[model samples]
Target chain A: MGKVKIKKKETRIDMTAMSDVTVLLLTFFMLTSTFLQKEPVTVITPPSVSEEKVPDSNLLSILVSPEGKVFLEVLGSKDSTMKSETVRADLLKNMVAEYKKTHPSANLAFTNKEMETFSKLNAFGVPITKMKEWLNLEPDLRDKFLESEQNPGIPINMNEDPNNPNEFQMWVRAAYNSMNPELQESMVKGRGIAIKADQTTPYSVVNVVMDNLQTMKMNKFTLMTALKTSED
Target chain B: MAIKSKSRQKKFDTRIDFTPMVDMNMLLITFFMLCTTMIKSQTLQIALPTNEKVEKEQQNKVKQSEAVTIIIDGKIDEKTGLSNPEDGMLYYYEGMPETDRLAQGESNMEQVEFGDKDGLYPAIRGILMKKNEEVVKRIADLKKEWKEMKFSKDEEKNDSIYQEKAKAIRNDSTLKRPVVIIKATPNASYAHVVSVLDEMQINNISRYQIDRINDVDSAMMIMVKAKNEKK
Candidate 1:
């Protein structure tokens, strides 16, 4: 029998097609993706059957951590960047005024650049007194400050009086007043306030937040939850 | 002509390696996957009445027969030293529990578990449905009609119809609907309260309020937990 000889073929086949497909996918994801905003604390929202998607804009998100610390995020209407900036600027001004009424000697004033930086932040929860210091920190240091155990959340006492409300209530009112009239109407119609709490957060903590809103006459709000899979 | 062709025929390899490019693409894809959130979160809308003093006239607005109170309380397990989610019991009662029974040192409070193997416990659903059968039936009928018309395709119309139906159910005086008062103990997790509220939404309950647990109610829960521990 003749010795069998097998032809040795080159192992290098074309990977150009694969690269092209992956590049296309990368582009698609990069263009359409919105990066997840870095939160001070991670929370797993409880699963629910409700299908109402959280509104993309004109939303005030109240994030409650498992440890009962509360953080807030305000996303203005998507159509106009100027409107949101204005809202943020006005919110800062109102917050300063409210802070001044409580502490006359404290300087709560911020420069325009500082106000712009604060307006651009995705989430904030530091006390008004420390807000200036928090914002002025280097980006890396700011993250460290937010993540540290020393950062107690904005003071939220049980004060129900509108005139002498808690800091949480003051922020909510400031956001409400600063937003465009249209957004305020939408909020009153139940599309504005969104509470995102950890699944393990105790009921008493949530109760306090709700009671604060109740005192402010913010009766309508939406609870943010993950979609419940059928198997669960 | 043959000599000229031979001289011109100098071949060069045109293949370029794409392994590095593919490697870069994989890295990019991984980055995108890590940074992007694929699922947009769902939202459960809730409306709570303003925190105002209940007037004497307004106190009688909810009929005794159409009232159900659900209390959620958490229990810590001794064996594992952890708060057992299963230990979170839901105590529900129709109308107010009799104080006389409490004075006699007997507890008449009824207890219901959360969801069972299949889903929401049928017994709880039965009680809720029986209490608000008329309104529930109306909501079912409207939902069926909406489905038959394929109104979901028209978002605005569907939303308006849903709003109208919810409003009508809220205002309907002829058909009595159960008014659920949800009370959670301090130890209970917010998830438990949200789950119970989700049930209210699922059962088409229009009138429900989250209230603070009172002293008598707290006493009843403690008694119930003690009884369960023995078992």
Candidate 2:
């Protein structure tokens, strides 16, 4: 009797099809991706059934933490000469002017380099008095300071008199006066400003921001929310 | 042409390994997937009355017969000092509040509980739906027609026509619709406020406005809370 001969088979497999699929997936992700903006505080907006989508550009979004801290983000026209960076720089200049109106003796200024750095940031909320010091810190340290407890966000309170606007109101005015007419027009129609707050935040905390806006005569604004189905 | 007998030729494999290339692409795809935000946030638009004080005669008044006020209040957790959205109270009153009878612990205001996950408060929904019965009935009939594509053969055309008709029915002045005035105390959770606003959309009531909790409202709420707790 002869022993059965064992069969030899090649062990290698082709990966070309796998590679093709992966590359196609990579292309899709790259095309449809919108990078999430970095914020000092993470807030989950309350859910609603309103179907209006937040505008991509020419918006001034206010971020309110549960602790009542506030931050401001600005975006300019999408296809205009007035880009976000340029508008941010102009806003800085206008803020400086606004601060000087109330405190003529306070010494506050930003160098061109500092302004450039500020323009690239996604959100800013430090008090105007400490803006220079905050801007001069290292990027890592600056972010820490912004999230720290000592950070008093944009000096807001219940100020009914528009003649004496609070720091938050001043920032809004500066954004409105920037060289972008589209922003101003939208603000008038009540679509330019958006309030983003945590779902668990107390109404009192949000009321302060709303009252400030109302006093500024910006009676119209939008509230940011996540989508919720009816059955939820 | 002495080719030197085509010196010993060697055959090589034609296929190249693509394992490393696929690995790199998989890594890149993971990075992009994590960095991207696929769902954009939605927005709720609201317009508040101007803060400037208006003259007594210049201020427009709502007819008392068509007014419905809803107040949202929540309890603050002692440990975290944060309001609990799940633990909240809803109070409503039709027409005007009767402060004159407050001394006797009696008022027109009544306390109500929020509905389950239905989004629309069941108790309040019944009241609002009855108040705006004419509009709701007509809108329901139109919605059925819309579902059947009665407006047009084209799907998009039918949808546009349905939307236009629904909007008209909501704004029709001839309908006896209720004016909803929403108020929230300082301790109310923001979620409750938003849910109340969402109800306006669901009920198709277009005359709702958010007003601040005045002193009179606070007093009335205290009375209602005391009355509710006693029961």
Candidate 3:
């Protein structure tokens, strides 16, 4: 009789097929899916009805701390590729210069307009002087102008057109002109600004932000919020 | 003869192995999916109405592009036990004519008044849900109606192929969105404050401009007539 021998066969799971399937699905979703981004900071928002979705490109953000300090955060701007930080640095310098002219002995004691003007920040995207107007800083701008001995034009609450006056528009135009050609190609089509504010803040601070945006002639915007609450 | 000998010895396997390439593609896709942001459709668009130099008339007629308002009047106190146990009236301007009326429930609306029997006190036109189970119930009811509305034209197209039994109770002048105007008394609580906004969402009303920012002098207050009313 012939002797019989038993041998074991391998039973390992061939991950190759599974891996291939996973890769196919990943590629499909990658090609078809859109990516949404939140602003770097969080903002508490007041309730409103309009549900306009702002696009991501060519957008800017201006931060308003609860203590009323304004931080300009520009992104995908019409001007310089590196606009916000540059613009912010320039604004602070200009504001300091303007402040020093009048309040020689005093630190910048900027007088803010009423609390309502701040809420407009999400609507308009402009520069510092226009931001001041939206914040309803009639007294501060007026005081600064009076101190510098320059004639103040009528305090126009032109919240719609922040970039209209030549002064605010010129800097923005320069920022756009200075961007690197290759980088500009990536961001040229974008058109929304995102405004992120804390909930406890009065509408006045927000208004100031929007007013500045309008003066800068930046119209489109996105207001950041936490995900909408779902029913249990 | 040498070339033939080489070919005869072995056949070369020319199928380039695709396994590793497929694995790398899957990893790349996973990374992009995690980073992608799905954008939401546009819902709210409000243009800040250019402020007119404060004119003399209390009933100042302002013109706007697609303007809306919220007039809150919550002075009724029937204290309807079925829902919303909050104090005073958190009234919503329902844009209905016959005063706050229910088509079926025990109607105590006529008995509600603001302070000294004038039929006003913060009534039930309010906002979002409250652990105020009643507030949530009302809001849900309102949301149900809004969700039923086919906002897009595609839904309307789908709806065209329907029977009379499938019709919704749409009135010709019923407000799809009521411009809420708050007329609350000075003593109204913060609940009233919340309900004004709540009612706006409940009714799917998006455009809202506070008549007066914060100061409530007679000059600051506004009145908006509800739709389908005989007042």
Candidate 4:
């Protein structure tokens, strides 16, 4: 049987132009786009109404990787650590201490639980209980202990603490005795903290963190936020 | 007349020309693409503690007593909400992941306030644990300083170490509940922050705040509790 070779002449699809266009598009996106792949923390921060323009470099960056590990910029680009609390604490303590000498009345302290008066605590905006935990140290006879402190407090000796788990009143007495005079003379002058949170972070995280910071007599505070990106 | 009209009649073409529609579509697409590249969104959530505005007088006194500064940085969500160190409910203390959140610290009679029941805490145990470690380290440092100082020295000098230690104890700044600074990225999640606060319960430290960097300076957001009512 003879075959009818009807349409082989005009259907030669020259995909050269298409291939060139694809390559061009790929290159364009790659060059013009910023893929922050190094971000390891995975969070969904709420929206903010702040409008601050911050520089990318020359600033201390506390990166929250998608996996939730903090990638701290301790000194500079040369030395950064993630998922290491020891390193972070060391660097932060040292830096803050240095900052404190120059700025004595700096709000650089975190708040404590149960201020010996307040009974409740909140995490984020929610109320998470730590009071019972604090009370655990107080024996069942808390009333008796309070009475003892009122009757005749323990001597201000190093070995006698009033805030210890077993003997809180005694630990409190010793803790007071351990105070340094010069710092006390200054009356714990004013200080502050600089916080930089990520965009995808949640509201509760900031709230709880704020609660922690309130303890150190660092009452004054300023919040930082990035200007929102425009959809225009 | 009818036969002559046949030559004058016009014939219409039925093929649709999509050139104008295509042009309009391309223009709209280009406009959207270009405009979208102009700015990016800053999606971050913040939960300021709900409390009666503090009196100016107390605020001033608190400001004057700038002893230790603490900061907590993290995000919040359903999972990482409400960190009660006093709560006994399993759900109440269940914090988010431990990577984020913080708690309170300590201070002196003059430097400290009586209540912060409205204060927040670590939702995650990990952050709280780290905070405890830092506080212990600070105490150790104070001990070392105490050891280094001469107890039998001149009055002014001998009293200095004691003063410093008293300040440290009074100005307890731990992340869990001592003096510590926290800087959370906005990208961190709610669960992450809550887990950190949960640790505050595990550790007995208290008093802290969330650190904020406003412009060229450092700032903070805090939780304040109502003063105890004298019944």
lDDT values, one for every candidate: 0.79, 0.89, 0.39, 0.33
User: Per-residue lDDT tens digits of candidate 1, residues A1-232?
Assistant: 9999998998898988998999999999999898998998888887777888998788889998766678888877887753666777778898887767767898778988889888887788899989988889888888888778898887896667877788898888888877477668777988889999876677777888888898888988989988875432
Chain B TM-score, candidates in order: 0.80, 0.90, 0.34, 0.23
Off by over 4 Å in 2: A1-7, B1-9, B52-60, B117-120
lDDT of 3 by residue, B139-211 (tens): 4554454457543346654345232212222121232323334443433432333334444444434434434
Label model 1 with its docking quality class. medium
Best by the TM-score measure: 2
TM-score of each: 0.87, 0.94, 0.42, 0.26
Off by over 4 Å in 1: A1-10, A83-86, A229-232, B1-8, B55-59, B76-86, B116-123, B137-172, B226-231
Model 1 native-contact share:
0.81
RMSD in Å for model 1: 3.8
> Model 4 over residues B1-231: C-alpha lDDT tens digits?
998889888778554455554455555545445543334323122233222144223223433222233222332344644322222111111111121222331112111221122223323333334545665566556556666665535766766766566556544643333332233334334333333333332343444333433321111132111112221
Query: Which is better, 3 or 4, measured by DockQ?
Result: 3
- Write out fnat for all predictions, comma-separated: 0.81, 0.91, 0.22, 0.09
> Model 3: residues >4 Å from true position, as ranges?
A1-7, A32-40, A44-52, A57-194, A210-232, B1-30, B39-43, B54-156, B159-201, B204-207, B211-231
- Candidate 3 lDDT over A1-232, as tens digits, reads 8787767875554566767678778867878776553332344443333344554444444454433344333343445554443433433344444434434674433343322333222222333444454345464553353223232221223344432433323333333443333223422332333555554444444455545554454433445443333222
Q: Write the per-residue lDDT of candidate 1 for residues B49-155, one digit (tens) a residue.
A: 77656622343687778889889887644453333344567888778666676754557677777666334556676777788788878887777777666556687
> Who is ahead in DockQ, 1 or 3?
1
lDDT of 4 by residue, A1-232 (tens): 8997787584444544544555565556545653332222333332233333332222223333222222223111123322222322333334334445545686654233323222221100101122233334454343343223222221111221212211212121121122222212222221112234443345344443344323322333333333423221
Please give the ranking of all candidate structures by TM-score, highest first, separated by commas: 2, 1, 3, 4
What are the per-residue Cα lDDT tens digits for candidate 2 across B1-231? 346546745568899999999999999999999999999999999988785354122224778888898999988788886777777788888888888988898888888886675455788778888998999999999999999999999999999999999999999999899889899999998888998898888889999888887787788889988988888
Clashing pairs for model 1 are: none
Kindly provide the TM-score of model 4 when superposed on the true structure, using C-alpha atoms.
0.26
